[model samples]
Target chain A: MPRDEFERLDSTWASVTPPAARRMLIAAAAAFSARGYHGTTTRDIAAEAGMSPAAVYIHYRSKEELLFQISRIGHATSLSLLTAVTGDDPVARLASAVRVFASWHAEYRTTARVVQYELSALTPEHLAEVAELRRGIEGAVREMVEAGVAAGAFDVPDVRGATLAVLSLCIDVARWFQPDRGRTPAEIGDLYADLVLRMVGAKAP
Target chain B: MPRDEFERLDSTWASVTPPAARRMLIAAAAAFSARGYHGTTTRDIAAEAGMSPAAVYIHYRSKEELLFQISRIGHATSLSLLTAVTGDDPVARLASAVRVFASWHAEYRTTARVVQYELSALTPEHLAEVAELRRGIEGAVREMVEAGVAAGAFDVPDVRGATLAVLSLCIDVARWFQPDRGRTPAEIGDLYADLVLRMVGAKAP
Candidate 1:
């Protein structure tokens, strides 16, 4: 089930953020992801968390801050999950990265939906920070593409475009995934890993 | 720069839709794309369209109607554009379709963004209509992929997954396209066509 991913995400979040604050952020993520940032109110978020509206400010300075935290945590987790796929070969690295990235997007789709879609609502300062983390994720993918091309492990015509497409395909999972629908997260990850390998023109291990 | 695409979309919209109603839809599409559907107010749309608040109601019954219209038009255009690319050969058809679809997404990004990203704001009845339209686009891609594989022109192992990725990559252009960014819509179209051609393991003709 999704319990493993949720627990993993929850513990990872708790490592850097307080539990009460994380609860508020979780509520904010769901509301923001579903109703959108502008549609969601602090009162709605507090109500979702089963707390009085006044209690929100004790944990988050504003509704935007709640969104900012969700975006931040989501980006950090995405970047870390992507960059963690390390190995001696770029082919394996790329496939592993795509698998993990795709899995996380599907598993944590609620948080990812807000993170990926609600960037415009973030304060400029916060948006910039999130963008940097996004760049980190992009950079990790670009590195794998370059490594594969340099080693002659893959035959990509346009490295930058392929890198963008790879990230694009993975991030879109958050947009379209429904847990009960067609494929499981693992199935999607496995499918995408193969498709990505083909994308890079990887011959074989 | 993007004027050609804007004019083209405008003319296409005018062909079937009334000019005044189209104007409101254009405004709502921009607002919904920029600020999100829920984030954008009917007042904001009316003001942006240079009409009084009540003028908006004269054209469209409600803000949701405005969104439904835009989504409907966008889906129609997307389906037409994708299916319009036809040839005896699957490779050529697929490349042409991706090129046109990607170009439109980049060129008419605001409309495409609202069409692609703002569907959740659409009421269920409207969303089902749009989803059928979306399925048309998917069916077009799937046919091309299946034809390519059947003809032995492409080497995709998983037809459904590859179809999903091709559409995923093209649709994502709406999410990330910036007119002032590095690549033009035409350029992106050409780049994606080549990449997608490569993606299907098509042997160079």
Candidate 2:
């Protein structure tokens, strides 16, 4: 919190932040989302990013690492959204959290698609990190569900199954949702939130 | 039914069913399912079939055609399962159909995974065919839900949204399901069927 310590922290962050590497990561995420990880090569990502294949190596050690970076960001964003939606009323909090999660997924579908479909390509260690992040997100939702049950605001029999079902509903949207689809993202998000509320046996507020 | 016509039909079918081609189709399905469509090549499929790549060409015109065949088979199998579960009671029939669907998806996760995930890789023409087949499956479920609604056996507010939510839950099991995850396919199928039934406000029979 001291001025000199804060300046040192900022300098250290700036030193590691490579703009070219960030562009390559974006390109890799897009390619990996369209084609599975096994289907893409470093050259393909490099071409998309307008960089030499060797330049990609300079930024990341391997294609898997690039994917891990994308997954890590997506998982962290989702966890942060969940953390930000806390409230005294668990039902209202859960509905808001579900809406935020669904909207984020629909808006950033490419990242979500890559994270969901290409997870098997990660090394065991990277996979564990991603899985742990996922568990943290699930835990947030589970806590809200448990709180609702304890407060008599929800009547779900199995909190874990309910959480999985709600999350599944949101995550699978990336597969079927198209921008030209009849429903807007917000419309879909609202509909899913209603469905999730019903599934959790939450009374309309 | 005449002998001459029967011979004509048999010869027509034989001309379409070369042994090398049959092997190629099977191998292509497995390859597409395992490595994904874009990740797989004709050579990989040919090697799996123990035939030369030229041999695969002799049977199918291109890899796209091979994918079309696999998608057709998967769609037909899924539709047949739904149709086979018809019953007098709409609720029972709905639950049974969902169980069959979830079980088939779990058992044949690989083929279902490929068909669902790699659908975008299909040629526009082939995609239309698959889409029609998918609509047929959705239509059957929609009709069942409508019947249940008419009979007052279900209390869902939005039939189309409910149908989509139900299908999404079942289709997405292939994404996260692992045999080592403590939940068997059958158990997951049962749990999903129960959850779907509850969501629709169906009374357990």
lDDT of 1 by residue, B1-205 (tens): 1456556667778854567777777777767766777778999999877888998988788999998988898889899988778899888889999999888888787777777777877889999999999889889899999999999999988888888888888888878888777899899899888888877888778
TM per model?
A: 0.94, 0.88
User: Listing candidates in order, what is each one's chain A TM-score?
Assistant: 0.94, 0.90
Q: Scored by CA lDDT, what does every candidate get?
A: 0.83, 0.79
Summarize candidate 2's per-residue lDDT along B75-193 as a digit string, tens digits: 88788888888778989888888888886676666667778888989999999999999998998888888888898888888898788878888888877777677777787777777
Candidate 1 residue lDDT tens string, A1-205 = 1455446656667854567777777677767776778877899989887889999999788998888888888889888888778987988889999999988888888778778777888899999999999889889999999999999999888898899989989998887888887899999999998888887889776
Docking class of 2: acceptable
Clashing pairs in 2: none
Docking model 1 quality class? medium
